[model samples]
Target: MKPAVLSGVHFITGDVACAEGALAAGCRFFGAYPITPATEIAEHIAGRLPEVGGTFIQMEDEIAAIASILGASSAGVKSMTATSGPGFSLMMENIGLAACTEIPCVIVDVQRAGPSTGLPTQGAQGDMMQARWGSHGDYKIIALSPISPQEIFYQTILAFNLSETYRVPVLIMTDEIIGHLSERVVIPDESEIKLVSRPRAKGRKDRFLPFEPGPNGVAPMAIAGEGYNIHVTGLTHNEKGYPDMTVECQKQMMARLTGKIQNNLDDIIKTEGYMLDDAEIIIISYGVSARTCHTAVDEARSQGIKAGLFRLITVWPFPEDQICRLAERAKALITVEINLGQIHLEVERCVKDKVPTYLVGHVGGTIITPERVIETIKEAT
Candidate 1:
């Protein structure tokens, strides 16, 4: 019997769609602990993984959950895990380990309202900054935000592909609303979906250098027990994968770790612009907040305000170039998010006071209303 994919259009929550997307992306192992708003992802994968001859294990905690997935990926299996805010906090240290060791894995954080378990069932975009800089280091990571079930399905696959291609842990920074919202989703046929696998090391085992980057600045990985001596560690190391404690070694290691994502921003960044061609006022948003901006932009246009939307799909490389370009012509920019102006700071930095910028946001127990966004547009105009 084959693993059944409900291939046709069906109504499902974003978490379930995310699980199906991971399976389609060839994820063979799932290691996670149950958490609110994100539990559905693990539950779906737990039932389906076995059918596809894959593995699913519920770890004792979030720390163990991330650690298990890292070990599985080191053994050459495509792996993933799902969590909410608290669990995501626990996984930070190991997330850094994955970055340093150059492991390919996907970690999904279905964000909830919280500094510490504030609202387990409610949604928030508070984790936006944390997703990029939570792990206490000078490394770069790729993160994506999806507003609907269908988009999350597609983005999940893209997250896996990016993780494998860049040899870094990719994050899906969705919120509780999108994670639990039910909508029609279409799972593409396997032939139509593109998947990326990690590049393997070439040549004799003795000659292999695990940390030596290729022309693309990503080193080809060698799986454990694959006739290659692979040494992976969190400590700064040289090309041979041994611990090297020199200022020069630290500088070289850190540069490549950050450069792999920074230099390839063109490939890693994605955004969508609406009515931006001649707009004087632009609204910037991501995740569920972006959904409301669409309606707000339309309403603002009805009132003779040249309002536009700049929705972020790939949140992390920050879309600095696009934001900077938009600032030149737009009269003002308004950033709407669930948190208290987290991404607004980034928008301000990019604009550099070229255009007036304002933040319309809350502390996140509910969604931002389109009426408020439209009102902000009117005021800005």
Candidate 2:
């Protein structure tokens, strides 16, 4: 099988760049439902998947779309799906299954304003918390946010890599603005790109402990058709993957499911700090909200506010250590996003009143301007 490489520089939307990134990341299966702001990703990848020995399926709804990719990943293929808010909510049940079963798949959520389909084409950062805790029960997740088309392309590939390496579903938490924004993007040659494949189950098939935690706390997976005794179920299971409905069994299962991500925080978390070396006030933001923050920081500097930007390239796993340490020396923290205060809540929780934390956000629809961010920075000061 060949990997698709859309090499070189070209002007493209974030949606198209995401598709190319998935292809380049060795994602050979694309299963998705049509939803505005995110539909372009499916539309673009559908035409391209076939050209590189990949499969593209249009599922009836978000639930089926996610299930299809889960099945595809179990069959030893890199798989992914994209959806907006409502569809994202629809997939929560299955996303829990993916977490428990330890399936490797990428889920791109191109968010719009919504509790229930508020805006199809408009952008919002409301689902940051949902992407982390939408599903029932507790299982760790890795989520990435990109500020622009070029970064979205990179983040998508990184999402797949993280998913494969950790054998868990990774979320690409982008908003409609980044999804639809057209800009210059560069797709490097296949040789220049780095990709990660899941660790295939090794040793004798008969004695293989499918759910046994390895050194990294992640079990080596046995692909379905490869013939190892693979019992992939959401039920609390042992190393042998048999259903065990007892407290002891549930405890062990939860440890494996959540431990792998918790142990590798350094590897899974990514963030970019700008002008933070000596900054007194920090602007914490992610996705589209982080876009104008660069200008806001610059403008804050021009006015001598000593403000800096903390860009959450990776949102999930919370980066609490970094936030806490930054808060220790900083005078204030301003969380910026389209939502009223989803991520801001997390920021506040991390700071624990060490420094003042404020939110500069709205319900949704429009992008937050640099001037607004600067205003918030001023208020925080």
Candidate 3:
């Protein structure tokens, strides 16, 4: 067999491709606790890293898993951790730490039914909001959703680039269905992809402030053991890593931490539209559920219904502006997900007054289907 081609590239499963993506993204450190649906990510990385002279550790728990990855990232290694919903919840505190300490790392959350282990092997999109605000505080995060295995591969690499460029933790917000689904994925050559490394302090090492804003608000991070003697902490710290509680210092730190992402959001956020120009009804979804919605919209279009599909590749820093534009012309918006009404609320918020938003959701172990979504769109249109 030669290889499967997509967009003229080869194919692979979302999970396996994710590991390959991480390796290609220059992730040298991986610390993760095994969990259902997402275990393949760790397994693949564990096997692949040794060949690339990288390191992979199966930590005792998700908390330690995330903490270790953050620590590695602080040491100036591109790092990652993979987990499902239950494990993802356990890593919240350290995730907050990564945010405050400005550690660049990637966290892959292959979501399953949640709220205390609702379903282990099943798929769910329940963690959509959690990815945005699971960790405490006001720090912003960037999250990417993959609807297919091929997308998973590409998005994982993009996740690392965004994290490094923004000096923040990036989340690959995948789901059980897509994680396990076997599909073809092409590995792009490095030259064809944009790779962003953390900016380095150019001069005056003695005067270097670890957290000081650079040209884009993201500070260049020097490795802890490096001659720069960089100090990192979770406390609200000033440029010198000393805890600063003054109103001005706090404001400046928060603004820079958030502004890095907000200011460059247009470059980070991505969405795909299908048959949108002629559609009266829009199907909005992300992650694994998006595939179903895409199929639904295609079927609806064939049935003479003006239905379009909007797939959210960047789930966080949500596509409010683009969504608002769609809402203006859309008669109705239908959101489909494996979890009950998680992303549906977001769609409602985006298109509230302009159009009615309908949710086609499933709970526990069930997966939403294209047929059901098409029916909902038909009724709405």
Give the candidate number with the greatest lDDT. Answer: 1
Ranking by lDDT: 1, 2, 3
lDDT of 2 by residue, 190-274 (tens): 8988988888899999999998878898888899888896887888888899999999998888888888998899998889999
User: By TM-score, how accurate is candidate 2?
Assistant: 0.98
For candidate 2, give the lDDT.
0.91
User: Can you write out model 3's per-residue Cα lDDT over 1-381, one digit (the tens) per residue?
Assistant: 211111246555688888888887788899978999899999988977777777899999999999899888877789999999999999889888888888889999998887787788888888888888999989888999988888887888899999998888899988888888887677766667667788766677788888888888888888877778777778788889888879888888888888988898788899998888888998888877777877887788788898888889998988889899999988988888777787777788888678788989877476787889977987897
lDDT of 1 by residue, 319-346 (tens): 9999999999999999999999999999
| Ranking of predictions according to TM-score | 1, 2, 3
How much lDDT does each candidate structure score?
0.93, 0.91, 0.84
Candidate 3 off by > 4 Å = 1-11
In terms of lDDT, the poorest run of 10 residues in model 1 is: 1-10
Between prediction 1 and prediction 3, the one with superior lDDT is: 1
**Superposed model 2: Cα runs more than 4 Å off:** 1-3
Q: Candidate 2 at 77: error in angstroms? A: 0.6
